[model samples]
Structure formats: structure tokens, C-alpha cells
Target: MDNIFGDAAERLFAQTCTPDVIRRAEQGQPSGDAWRACEEAGFADALVLEDHGGAGLGLADALPVVVAAGRHLCPYPIAHTLLARAWLSRVQRPQASGAIALAPQGLAIDDGRVAGTNVAWARSADYVLAGIGGQTWLLPMQAARIEPNGVHGSLDGGVSWALADAERIDHVAPLETLAASAYTGLIAGAMDRVLAMTLDYANQRTQFGKPIGRFQAVQQQISEMAEQVWAARMAAQLAFQGEDGLPRPLLAALGKARASQAVPRVADIAHAVHGAIGVTAEHDLQLYTRRLREWRLAAGSESHWHDRIGADALASRSDALTYLRTALYGKETA
Candidate 1:
């Protein structure tokens, strides 16, 4: 129910993360200053508890903050730390404060050689949380390759690395799943921003001596976009609210499902409303919509979530229906 990160996030976004700075970050230029401002904003500490200099908020509380960052396309790793530090708490790494980046393809752990990390953002990360051989590891960033790639996506032209010195840390929960959910939440939030901007454009842009939004066809598109955004928002809320020791896969899948569907719909509406200008870099709408597309397929696509949901449904059958029923009725059945 706590939707705000106080005034910290707002102040940081307004003062430190200006539109120009964000554009630079999105264009693949890493700004240590902006990243540091993010640290100052308490984003890096979202996962770390108060005792460890964090806000001590759980995933539900932190979702909005992550979503806001996604809307702005802020190129910092808030969600990664959220996953890593929360898991590290179990193993007494409660004092950790740094950016974390989850590998989309996962890492491999082998003897004397680290594997399983593909497409990492370790260049900007002070520390790393890695997955290896069904175990989690906290390792120094130097151990990974940090392979250099262009700024085609959000990685910012940074190099990715494999976990060469992935030291297994026992008892720490894996942050991969949580990271997935947060990433999905962020995309969903960005979609909301995109739709709103598109609606505003439709309202203001006049053609044939009338505002485009006054037309029924334009209104229908805007309405559909709104519905999609609302559905994704609900899904994100479900994922956040159900983070009470629940398996991350389920919540993550749900969040991803909602977002993946909503983003494209939102993007289409935005472009349609803005016409030729929407695709231009000059408009901020493109930034949000572009990142929405990138992030939509980054973690997992719609096909991935649908398969996951289908698997869950098949495995539980009536028990799953009971769970759904419980959610509707506010009580779990035996």
C-alpha cells in the first residue's frame, strides 16, 4: 500500500536526473555522476535494510520506485541490488550497497572457470550477484569478462562478463527471479507513461480543424491503451503484494505477462497518435516507448510467461483454481 519513496525519488529525478542526462545515459554514455546521484537518492540502498543504510522496504514497497526509473529510462541498476541485497540478507551480507545486474541468459559454474553469465552490466557494478550450478554467488566484478557491446539496448554499450571467480555463497536466495519481477514492473510503469503521453498528444494535435482526440477512432485507441496499462498495473500490484515469501517465478511470470502485452499496445497507440513525430528522437515519447520495447523482451517475452502460466495451471489443476478462488474470496481452501 506504500506507494511513495517519500521525497527522495522525486527530488533525485527532478534535480539530478534531468532529461538531457537521461538521454545521454540512454544513448550509451555511462555517467558516474548520474549513477552516484542515484546512490544519493537511496536507490542503491533500497535492498539494503536500515541497519545497512537501506530504506528497509520490501519488493511491494520498492516496485513503484523501480517503475518510476523505468518510465524515465534511468540507466541505473536499482532492481538488481533489490534482488541481490534482499537475498544476501539471509547470509549476513546485510551491509552491501552497490548496483547489481542480472544476466538474461544466466551464468555457468565450472571448475576453476566461471560460466553462466551472459550479457552482464558489471562495468558499472561495484559488486555482483551471480547464479552458478543451482547456487548463488557474490563475487568481485573483476572476475567477469565485461565484454564490450554497442549501445543497441539499455546496457549502455558496456561490456558483459562471465563469473570467473564466482564464489558460492550459501543460504542466500537467488535474486534472478526477483529481478525479473522488478524489471517487468518497470516496463509496465513505462507503458503507463507512454499511453498518457499519447493521449495528451491526441488531445492537443488538431487536424481538419478539430482535435484528433475528439474523433471516436482516436478515442478507441486511447481507451484500449488505458485498459492495457491498467491490466499491467494490476498484474504488477499482484506481483508486489504477493511477495510474502512466495516463489519469485510465479509473480515474475505474472508481471512479465501483463507488461509484455501492454507495452506493444501502448507503443502502437503512442506512434499512431503522434504520427511521424513519435518515432523521432526529439520527442521524449520515443524514449519511453523505445525502452518499453527493449525491456519488454529483455527479461522474458509474452510467450515465455504464457508457457510458464500454462505449466503452473497444468501442474495444479483444481488446486490452482482454488488459489484463484481464494484470491477472489480472501481465504485459501484446503
Candidate 2:
């Protein structure tokens, strides 16, 4: 789908998210400039209501911007901020500024405050949205004592907020499913880039005096990689399917499960096809591959969603087959 939001975001990132920018971000550089560009372009506020001074686009419309960010390996929390703004507006809370790192599943509130470890982008984010389901707390990073873990090669870290300063908003929209859908979209876009890069390399890199694309073994790996790539693409489309711009929970779970499952194999095949050169710091392959690995674990792994699906099926009144049909096709079984 050709959308002004997606098209503009693609163009914006293409110019700002160059190899040098990715390298600098991976090296722990601040992503202020790129983030400023996004903020100025009004991408984060894409989903907020027009009455709230936003474009009031739906999740389906705004997701392309997130996918574009993933395709470009955007260093900041663009998707997180988009979801946050949307949620804040849903509960009639004041529209927030600055990058908001969303912690959808991890951490909990106690005594009106939240403390959590393994918060992605905690070191760099201005605020963290901590909650489960419809209730969420927005805590400023300035009030917290941030302990940077530096894990996953990004801004992942541990943070403890001054709970008294927390802004708690109840009856907010559930974010886990929203996050899952967007994460799957990111996986789809990143895998597309990786597959394209691998294909180009296979046709160019020579082995035994011939291009590796001509070899049966290398061709087999590329074929497998292509299968997963398209599967992820299809899964993302399914995940984003919903009514009135809202994603169905079952669809989100299935999409995230399938997309997350594709990550390890896709990253492995891309590296395997390129041999040692793919992992070199100077090469661009590792940049995307590492983020692919990280995104797999974000929000929840495949196993987490798989178990959720299985449990739901078992708990449903209908048979397994009917449940599956209802989940995938939205048709109720008699």
C-alpha cells in the first residue's frame, strides 16, 4: 500500500539512516539527530486522534513507518513512541513528548512505582511505559537511577524510578498485542533487506572461480532463506490484519510467533551464505543480523506466543480445528 506516511518515512530514513549512522549508533552514539528528524516529521504522532493534534491514523496505516524504521535499523525507539502516543491519547492523557521506551510484558508496579531490569533503550529513552494490558505507568527517566547494562549492543539497561513521580493511567488500551504486531512487521522488513543483500552477494562473490549462486549447496541455503523471508512477510500482513485499524489478538500472536521463529534461521543462513565476511564489523550484514536476533527476543519469543496460542485453544469451548479456523479466518465454527 502506497501511503504518504510510509513513503515519507522511507525517504526520511533513507537519507538519515545511512551505514555510518548505523555504525555510530552501534558504537553507543546518541541518536538525537535521527530522532529529531522523526519527531519533526510527525511520525510518532501518526496514530493519535486529529483532535489531539495528531494525524489520527490507524495501526495498519502507522505500522509502515515502523517497518521502515526496521528496514533502516533505526537506532531510536520510533515504534515504541508511536504506540505510546496512541495509547496516551486513547485514555485522554496529555500527549507526551520525547522518545518513550515501552516495556509491555516485563516489570510491575508496587507502591505506585516501578523497577525493572532488561529495559530496552532505558539508557537513552526519556520515558518508559511500564504496564500490562490496559493499565500503564509513564515514568520519566530523569527520576530514575539508570544502570546501563549495555547488553544486546544497544541501550538495554536496568532502571529504578522515583515512583512518586510516576504518571499512572488506567483503562488504557492493551499494548502487548499492538507491540507484537509491530514487531512482526519489523521482522518482515528487516528480513527482506537481509534476503536481498544475500542474493546480491551470492551473485557477486566467486567461489572456485564461479559465482556461488551457481553452486547447489549455496543455492539450497538461499532457497531456504527465501522461504522464511516470504513466510515472515506473509505473517506480518496477517498480524496487521484487523478491523478499524486495531489488530486482532490471535492474529498478532500467530504472526509474532511465526516471525520470531524465522529470525534464527534467517540470520544464520544469511551469515552462512556470506561465510566469515558477513560477521565482520566492517560488513553491513552483521548490523542487520544482530538486530534481527535482538528483535526475536523483544516483546516475547516464538515459544511464548506459541504456548499462549496452544493454551487458548485448549481453553476454548470449540474443538482445536474450529479454534484454529476462528483464529486465522475469523469464522466461527458451529
Candidate 3:
């Protein structure tokens, strides 16, 4: 498919979506304005069909926008929105408006219960989409009691909205796959930012009367970081290419597994080379790294994705080569 993203999104990122906006998001400031701004700018409408007021862009084109958002550590519920759009489309749900997070399997639907939710973003969203017993549920955002949660003291903040059983509605979709896809894209985007920032830091920071990048050890670290990003990006792109037939669950599983592994490696290398300054909250690297770690466990953790992918592969009784080719290239030619 053609790339739907042009220069406009990039320009917007440079002009309006600055690092400070991300800081505000970290501080629990209102991101509704930013979210609306992105929606108006065509990013939110990427996956939606033209009939649904979207550009009908495929995953290939939408990947870059996700990457950009991740790079900025954007706090706008971009991933949630993406998942919501996908879930609505698959289930043919019309006029569905809300923020959606891919919760862990088996959320409790008991009276006044709000469980199994993870990384939920819609603090003020009109609705919340959740997964329960392989089904998606739509709940009013205001109904649930939101509990503030964070990751490693970073602003990996989220709320657990509790709802009574009577208020629950069953709306099922391929949520596992949707969550995996969006999470993969978000982490890959953040990985790209990590690589860029680390590279610049290496070049700018001086040591022993020369740039740290000139040192062999530092260069090796940078090379390894780049390689990790490359691996993660390739996995993400391959997953995107097979968006049609590839099971979203399996694809998302692999995407997140690779990203969870790659992101921390990249961040560790960057911080090691950048030294103590890199670890501080004030530095931009921590912002990206913290979010990376948080997103890793959001849709599912590394172990979760790994087991899911392994199970799918093992359960596929068809020819392995055919499955592989169809998965990576979108087709299998005998």
C-alpha cells in the first residue's frame, strides 16, 4: 500500500509536538487537546475507513506516525485510539467513541468491579474498551473508579476504572491482535528515538580529550544499540506487511516480544555510554526508556508474547515454510 503519511505529520511533530508537551503529559496534564489535535491532523484517522471519517491508510503508512508519537513519548492516547479503531472495524461497531487499552485476559465483570485493565489512558474519554474472555467490552469512562498506577516512578501513569456488572456490555473483537499491533508500533517508534538520541549524545559528549563516540568501546555500544533497533524495526515492519492474514495475536506477540527485549538493551547501552546523566529523570533518554519499559508490559509482557507466538507456531500444522513465507511476504508462491 502507498504511504499515507507525508511531510505534514513530521512538520507538526517538530513545531507543536515538542518534548515539553511530553513533559506535561508526564505530569498528568490534560492531553485531550493534543489528542484532538492529532485526530484532526489525520493520525487518529489513519486506520479508519473513509466512510468512518478516516484516510483508510494501511499499517505500512500508519507505522511512521506511531513511531513519531513514541519518539516524542507522547501521552496522548494514540495507541488506545488505534486499538479502538481496529476493534470497532473488526466488530463492525458504528459510532464507537472512546479510549481502549488491551487488558490482560479474563477481566472480572462482577458488581462494582474494574479488573484486568492495564495501561488504560482515557481518564476523561467518553468510553473505555476492554477485553474479557476473548471479548471486548465497552464501558463508560466515568463509571469506573480509576486508580493511579505508575512504572518505576516514571509517569507510566494509568487508572483502573471500576464498574458494576450491570453496566458492562459485551463487544467482542480480535483485541489481542489489535493490542499487540499498536503496542509493537509504539515501542518500535520509541526505539527509533532512543537510537537517534544516543548517537547524538555520543558525538556531543567529550571524554579523554576527544568525543566519546571516537572511542572503540563507545562505538561498539552504539553499534549494538543500532542493531537492536534494526531488529525491532524489522519485526515491526514485517508484522505490518502481513497485516491481512497474519493473526494479530501472533503478530502482536512477536512484535512486543522483540520490542520489549530490544528497547531495554538500546536504553542500557545509551545510558552506559552517556553515563550518570542519562539515568536522571531530567534527561530526555529516561523519558523514552521508562515509557519503553512500561509499554513492554502494557499489551502483554515479553513472556506473554513469547508463549503466544510459540503456541501459534506449534499449532500451525501446515507447512512451516509456507507459513513463514505467507507471514513475512504476505503470500506463498509454490
Candidate 4:
């Protein structure tokens, strides 16, 4: 909620995450410079304790940084890095400077080794954090046999790994919850940028000797886009605020579901408004649109979170209105 931190993040991202930098990253070139700059700016360690070589900022303070990173489409494993730092601090392990990957599911740990397919960003990670049978493990990427798959949208590609006899560590934070929270911020940032681009284009592009924005149909679509972006931003803020001492799953599910569902609608409207140019790689719209779609399915899909929300609501056993109120606002209805 504090613009002090958010504004600083925005300035840093604006300076570091330039279009050239993003273009280089999109071409599969190393983005080490931007990542190092981000680390120097304390973003990589924002979630860790100061005593443990981090900024010691709360989730509220750290999330805006994530939002800024998303807005610029920073070509780094930012969410993964934040989650890894938190896990490392929790387990008292020294944090490494390289990227970290999360093994969400379809992975098994046995005899001190881990074997899994399609581990997100495993090719670039120095460490891979995984949950196994209610316990967490941190595997060294160097020890793993990594096979790179093709890229997934604008985000980095996934990898398969066979890591033998890797080490395991304890983690205090739920990786999924942290990831979902960060992703909510990322989606909000993307939508914000897309809406701005669409608005600018609508006002500048003329049809029938008048700006397209002057037309009622285009105005209505832009209005809907603005509404969705606002809703997504609010959902992300609510999720960030509810991160501490609240029902994390409910808040995360709500934020992520709302934002994810908005992705297709927002992307369609943005592309439609921009005409054929928006779909081309030459245009900047693809950068935000691709990431939005990828992030929507990353931690969990909208359908997945919808099921979780439904299950939580069913478990509450109260009227729908009361449950909705308590879930969204964290206040019980009278």
C-alpha cells in the first residue's frame, strides 16, 4: 500500500528493464545484467530477513516490487527467486545468487535423489525446491541431469531433471501460496500495461476521419478493460494484505482465479482494439499478453483455484453471502 517502496521499485524497473534488455532475453540471451541489477537493488532478497542477508521487508512491501517486475516483464525468475530466498532463510541455508526453480508436482524424491519432468526453469536454476510427502527438499541444480524443453510463451522453458542423492531442507512458507501471491502482482502489472497501451492506441488511431476511441463500441470495450484491470489489481492487493495470519488458500485462490479469468478477456479486448498489429512480435503487446497467459496457468489454473474456493465455501457451511464476505474481507457477517 505504501507508494514509497512501490515507487522506488518502479523507478528501478524503468531504468533496468528496458525494451532492449527484454528483447535480448526473449532471444534466449542471458539476462544476467538485469538480474544482477535487480539483486543489487535488494529485490532478490526482499522477502528474507535482514539478519539473513535480505531486506527483511514484509510481504506487503515485497509484492509491489513483484508488480513492478511484472510491469516491465523482467526476464528473470523473480517469483522463483523470492520463494527460494524465503525457503532458504527458513531452513538457515545460505542463499545463492542464481535462479531457483519450483517443482510443484509429478516429482518424487527417493534415496536422497529427485527425478521429475517439466520442472519450471530448472535449466537456469541453481537450486530446485520441492515438496515431498509433507516435507521440503532443496536440490542442487549442478548435480541434476537437465534436459531442456522448448520455451513456454514468453517465460522460460521447463526442464526435466534427474538429481541423485540431493539434500533436503525445511521450509516455513508454502511455495504455492507465495507463488500465487507474486503471480497476482505480475498479472496486475501486465494488465495495467496492456490497458495503457490499448488506451493510447485507441486515441491515436483514426477511423472514418475520427479517432477509434470516439466510437461508442471501442469506448465500451476500453471501459471493460479498465474495469478488469482494476478488479485484478484489487484482488492482488487483497491477497497481499491477507498473506499474514489469514486463510492463505482462500485469499490466494480468490486473487489468482479472478486475475487468471481476466487474462483471455483482457488479451482479446486489447488485441481487438489494437487491430492486427497487436498479435505480431514486432508490437510490444505480445510481451505482456504472452506472459499474462503463461502466468495464469503457472502456479495453478483458474479452474483449479475455483475448485479450491468452492471446497472452502462448502466447508464453511454458512450462507453464500456470509461466506463470500468473510472470505473476501476477512470479517464475519452479523
The C-alpha lDDT values of all candidates are 0.66, 0.83, 0.66, 0.75
lDDT of 1 by residue, 210-327 (tens): 9999999989988998899888887777666544322256667777777787778888888988999987778888777766776777667878777877786676655666746653
Per-residue lDDT over 120-147 for candidate 4, one digit per residue giving the tens place of the 0 to 100 score: 6554456777766776777777677655
Q: Residue 265 deviation, candidate 3, in Å?
A: 0.9
Q: Backbone collision count in every prediction?
A: 11, 0, 6, 1
Residue-level lDDT tens digits of model 2 in 1-334? 3488899999999999888987887667877898899899999898888998989887778778877888888888887788778767877899778988878867666666577877867766788887743577788988887776656566677777766878877666667787788789889888988999999999999989999999999999999999999899888878877754467888989999999999999999999999999989889999899888888988899999999888887778677777878856577665
TM-score (all chains, Cα) for each model: 0.85, 0.92, 0.87, 0.89
Top-down TM-score ranking: 2, 4, 3, 1
Worst 10 residues of 3 by lDDT: 150-159
What ranges in model 2 sit over 4 Å off? 109-113, 132-135, 150-152, 327-334
lDDT by residue for model 3 over 268-318, one digit each (tens)?
897898789988878888878877877777767788878876676678665
**TM-score winner among the candidates?**
2
Q: Candidate 2 vs candidate 4: which has greater TM-score?
A: 2
TM-score of 3: 0.87
Cα miss at 222, model 1 (Å)? Answer: 0.8
| RMSD of each candidate relative to the true structure | 3.2, 2.2, 3.0, 2.8
Give the number of the best model, judged by lDDT: 2
After aligning candidate 2 to the native by TM-score, how far in Å is the CA of 27 from where it should be?
2.8
